[model samples]
Target chain A: MGEKIMVKGTEAIGEAAIRAGCKVYFGYPITPQSELTEYMSRRMPQEGRVFLQAESEVATVNMMYGASSVGVRVMTSTSSPGFSLMQEGISYMANARLPAVFVDVVRGGPGLGDIQPSQGDYFQVVKGGGHGDYRLPVYSPSSLQEAVELTIHAFDVADKYRTPVVIFADGMLGQMMEPVEFPDPVDPSTLPSKDDWALTGARGRKARYVTSFDIDPYKLEQMNLVLQETYKKIEAEEKKWEEFMTDDAEIIFVAHGTVGRIVKSTVKMAREKGIKAGLFRPISLYPFPYERLAELAEKVDIVMTVEMSAGQMLEDVKLAVMGRAETPFYGRLAGVIPTPAEILEAMMKEIRR
Target chain B: MSEQVKDAILLASMPKALNGKEFTYCPGCHHGIVHRLVAELIDEFGLREKTLLVAPVGCSVFAYEFFDVDGTVAPHGRALAVATGMKRAKPEMFVLTYQGDGDLAAIGTAETIHAANRGERVTTVFINNAVYGMTGGQMAPTTLLGMKTTTSPYGRDPKREGYPIHMMEIMRALPGVAYAERVKVSRPQDVPKAKMAIKKAFYAQLLDVGFGIVEVLSTCPTNWGMDPVEASRWLEENMVKEFPLGVYVDKVTEVMKEKGVK
Candidate 1:
């Protein structure tokens, strides 16, 4: 209920977390996400909470793990390469089923990827980028408002699933300024109690064991089975997506993160040209809305997957459609942010196909 | 040996798991014995539930499985970082890191030095068994001169690779360490002394007495191509001469002495 003030997506996410009652901010200053960490560096100390510029990305995630283990709302933000460095710790947190927010502002490449924007980490984020048979609820936001909302939802989903949650963004979304409004600050007291798992100074209870240990081989396997079942429940219950005009579109534009925002403008231009084009944005990357995509595939003739990498999400789009519709792809690689015109160009190609 | 002498030995005998479990150390390897001693102390002190053991990745990647209580497997040489996180997060909880010479002195050198330098109220259980045992007994920073291992098959040349690091001297240099002692668990007679050093390290974490390390001169019989008996003897002769057994820093009662709100 207020006029919009311009803010970078990264800063907006940090401010949103602070408003959402996050107590600890642990991060290493990497490109793109540096704005978020800088915001925390200035604000967190004043708020009388903990803010640590950790030794490394690995240490940063571990710090988030430590703080999260004790029931404090904590988060760590980084980019693609830094997120790669954090995979082991992220896997560790996933195994422990710790609820903490991780923001991966994607950049390009296999190593020390470029500091500029890219959506190369879509597969990594959705597939539980760590070395474990585990999954975290990953949210891909299109705009500054979506970034804040998705980040808040990421924390909630993390707590609900008792697993790590990721707010997957790109450098463009992180650096670009836009207006945003936070829903409401969650009261720590009102939040769902994690008494069973959290190692807080709560009332009488046996030492809440937070470990990935089941001594017996059969028992460990059974534990893994149980985790898998829980993941299934998440996939079934928490799939969120947004559709613009999939009702009678011959061609659909499937994209996410900042690329999704660009896709929207392309769809509008395609509609002006009398071409049937629609936008499908996957808000949750994991527990991916495949069922919905398959249903929509029946209605569309061609589905064009647009991403900032050499066609990573294209494979997922194909899987989601499962060959019901002819799925094609377009990509902008290595720190290249796809413009609306570029996406429109891709959409025209999709319409012709 | 009379009944009273036998009873004295029985009372001194370590319990299981403090006898810590299933160490993958080679024969003549004193790490197993020393690890057992740490476990025994933890068992005796009833610290199984309260203690957070930080096991580094060198030879102890799966140590979390052996440790009964909450055990975190830290990255190579990053046991200090993991322990620091645990200690800072749970200020009231006991945090101790079990590290090897290679892990602490090599890649993780900075973390080990900084944690000690900062007096992070974390205890380090430094196992200074002259050579790296897991990766085919290669020369460690603490490897004694002329000690033949995989890396130094032609004997450790002081001219090329410098002399062995004196950890006791290094520990003494750091102001954070409340206690740093070089002990060898090669002999049955010396196991108790090694346990005492380990116990002090554990207690230092319990009492918030800053960084404490117990450097145990372990023997690896397999690497030495000797039986357990000979390796123990080798440790006494060659190892003890290089890393002379003694305390580098001792302020076990510093917490009790300090007149301030912790």
Candidate 2:
């Protein structure tokens, strides 16, 4: 750890992106994540970078398409509704194979819901938020420091795979402050050039073109196949999760992001009560660590899922468990965050059955 | 044929800014004409190496393959927004957006208005063909009143389909706009004037002035259900009535006059 400083999750992400060498940021202001945009606006231009407040969420994502096509590191942050509006651009960028980072500080959704923290966008983010056959490598962080680390790592993974990466954080994380050690700033000038496909001016070379329109069906199919192969490589190499005391537990709880942090506390409380409980947290949600969860599910008597949404990620947990154990979900819907005590009670109730 | 080719001398060949590929435009389409004019202007200004074209998702979606300069295709109606990002990030690169009527005046109206209002150092070539050619002749926002289209089979009614949008007039009113012109490519005489208007727009960006736009009255012969020759005549007779030609804004010239330069 370097010099420790306290920052909100949003601020931590903004600083991390700068450290990760993001030179361009285009975003529209929204609740929960506005601080990230605000910080970028104030600091990016002063550092001789581009920070533009787009006219709308739609325009903001399209701007990323343009910036990334020029081989520049770029990022954007938004809440739920704004994230929804960006789905079309996300699909386009995915098809065009442009790399950029997007952070969704999730709030209660299904409409113009409350601006409070929620995990409702799990299905949308992990199961392809946009149209077509594509996936974004998603990261869900449990703390401010982890958000910073994962945010910095997101840029690397996105650039490596040439795919968009989404940081699936919640409003609670965005608003809460915690002590974090900042990483060393990356020299943007030292980054590798993307001349292989970037839309830099074609002076003495063949013109570089970036587009998703394939009029021929066979060619489109081949393009989709290429994307799928890349995704398969990512899944084979990048499935990450953390298992806490799951080796000797009879009952396990699966969760992620802010809810996972709460479940960790619940596991400690349940252990003191002589309940053999452990927590399984998935750090990468899209290429989820299902194999580890499946192994634990076979050993445990029950696998309980906890979340801030009604029960979106519960389906994934159940799918991983594969009928090896009793899979039950307990959640607080529409921005209601459950306490550790409430989660313990639900776990006890489910284990009793 | 070889003797005739030799006698022609190839004095004025295709502009090098254009890739050596045959156009995919339909017969009598004005996109071909506008593409040639823009390519010649890019060649004339020696911007072939520093230009980036953002083509729209209409009939020009494949324009990246047609231009020998670096280019990308924007989503439907988002050409200006993408161009804004490119220009702002790489100020040394001259960025341009090529869009049609539906893209500029309808679905992308917000992007078009906001980019010009911000005085982004970019140029936009608006091809107002008055119909959606790619989607098979739907009524466009720039379609003249009483014009027949697939969506307006009974002829467009002003109360129902709305009046033709004058992009040049609208863009000229923005203070950040340095130049705005409405030109046509219906006749051989119009081609030179159209090329001049396009070159002026490109110059606005090269000089780092405000945003510039050139609205070209184009034709969609197949969509208009007319032959190539008849479509040209129809545009000269009808389309010109609602969208008149000439420069509507010339703030670059105004500044030059103020500075007593040219």
Candidate 3:
């Protein structure tokens, strides 16, 4: 077992990938995510791997594109606008069905909004962040330890589905230091055989071919159908949501990522007041746990969706409820992280309403 | 599972996978010649299994069909980025990006400069034809002065659109480039010399030297509104004058020679 140590969430991600046999790291410097790149730049070279500081956000993403195409485990980390610049590369990765891990340490943003911790990229990440008809499995981790563990698992999920997977966390998780006990690093040799395809030289296997262009609409539609079927399996198997103090609750609050931390404290305060409020925190944003929300909607009186952006995840919550209950939205736009007391007050308003 | 072919690739034999489809190239398009050159090097270096080609927009976006190994298509001007992701994800794979003027020069300028600037282990094959062929002859970033096209119909004046970009000079200027050269497929006679240049560039990357590029000066007869013979002749007289042929930077072999490693 590796010795226990205090590490920043960003550094833990780099260490985990290193143990997972990740051979290459490429990224540009951006606030909120500077540590991930900086950590990798120092560590990867020591591990006898490639670590490059790309010239720009676009170049960094493309460098990621190049490295991933050759069948190596690789990644890039960035804040909002940098992540926005990577949308095009992300879309191509999704379309090409290349397995890769992208870490978005989201900061506040409409455009260069601020470097403060924020979950404003919920919609951009869970939904396709690029201009394409696709979805990358997105994992949101609230804890430092989970950030490390989830990133390793992200690579496996990406390879299993032949899709890009994002370990979605924010500045708070990336920036703050914590005592992290990481699970065993994923062993690459034990993973599934991609010998049937992958460009790392077609040696010893039938020449593997991969491309996104399907001139035939029927073929493209078929590809989408196959992808949808795979995503459905993920939705059923990987949809994760944690419910806290839901028993005999009056108003149930749905939150994700950093918002869940605030909501947890909010639930405790409401329990003290006998306000009977609870929290529903989504771990997998893409799988969404919509069915769980629908099931919970029947027992709860009011449902409130709390977010860093203006109620992006609320749309999915409302869709899940399907008018079974009124899904009220409480959103704090970029920069200001919703506080526990602020969320409790908002839930009280929902209970009064 | 690969079936064994009797002869080794180093014996100057073509791989069984290459379906000899007569190339679909504009007359004198250096892409076809460069494709053959690269294919030959892949055969020579026994890299048919390990090398993957990524073709970009402009005329040869369908390069996936031409190369017998694994290949993928990227969105316009995003080949370098796509290539980056591919190489990063699978480091052992020998990746090469084949890009043209409009694709690499104008839109993908950032990607081009930075990939070299980063000295990515991947080799780049830059086809520097001066006009946009597939988009029906527009003002390519490398279009010569006074060169007429659909967009620059009244001839390209330096004052209006700026002079044609000399990519080799720019690539040479970057400290990160291991090798950079301007080669031409202008005359059928110059084919071997062009092939030599391509092989050296690819070999540099194969040995993990650094970013290497062989800019193959090409022609588009239809876009240039010249006959096939005239296009090649035009490249010899005009294109060669503006973009001089020879190695702009020979750092790759020099490094090896200095160490007596090769």
Q: In model 2, which runs have C-alpha deviations exceeding 4 angstroms?
A: B1-11, B254-262
Report the C-alpha lDDT of model 1 over A1-353, residue by residue, as the tens digit.
34577888888999888877788887888887888999999988888877777777866776676667666677889999899888887887787778889999888887876788898887788887777689888888888888887788877888888888888888888878888876767777888886666655322433234555544789878767877988999988999899988787878889987788888888888888888888889988887888889888988778889888998878879998988888888888998877888788876666665
User: A186-213 in candidate 2: lDDT tens per residue?
Assistant: 8767676688888889978988788777
DockQ-based ranking: 2, 3, 1
What is the two-chain DockQ of model 3?
0.55
Per-residue lDDT tens digits for candidate 3, residues A1-353, read 66678998889888888877677887889998888898998898897888877777777766666666556777778888888988987887777777778898888888879998878887888888788688889998888777777788888888788888888888888877888877775676787776666665667665555766676899989877877888888887888778888877877889888788788898899999988888888888988888888888988778889888888889889988888787888878777888888888887777777
Query: Compared with the true structure, what per-residue lDDT tens digits does model 2 show for residues B127-208?
Result: 9889999999999998888888999999999988778888888887798888899999888889889888887788678776
In terms of lDDT, the poorest run of 10 residues in model 2 chain B is: B3-12
- In model 1, where do residues sit more than 4 Å from their true spots? A1-6, A19-21, A65-71, A192-220, B1-49, B58-68, B75-77, B131-146, B150-179, B187-209, B247-262
The deviation in Å at residue A14 for candidate 3 is: 2.5
Q: CA lDDT of A68 in candidate 2?
A: 90
Candidate 1 lDDT, tens digit per residue, B101-212? 9998887777777677767777777777777777778888988788778899888999988999876788799988888898887667888888788777766666767788
- Model-by-model lDDT, in order? 0.77, 0.90, 0.80
| Rank ordering of all candidates by TM-score, starting from the highest | 2, 3, 1
What are the DockQ scores of the candidates, in order?
0.23, 0.78, 0.55
Q: For candidate 2, what is the DockQ?
A: 0.78
lDDT of 3 at B53: 80
Residue lDDT tens for model 3, B1-262: 2334443443255544354566888665667667777887787677778777887876788777767877777767877767766665566778888899999999999888877877767888888879888889999999999999899989999999999998899988888788888888777678888887877788678767888888988888888888889888898899999999999877778766766765
Scored by lDDT, model 2 comes in at 0.90
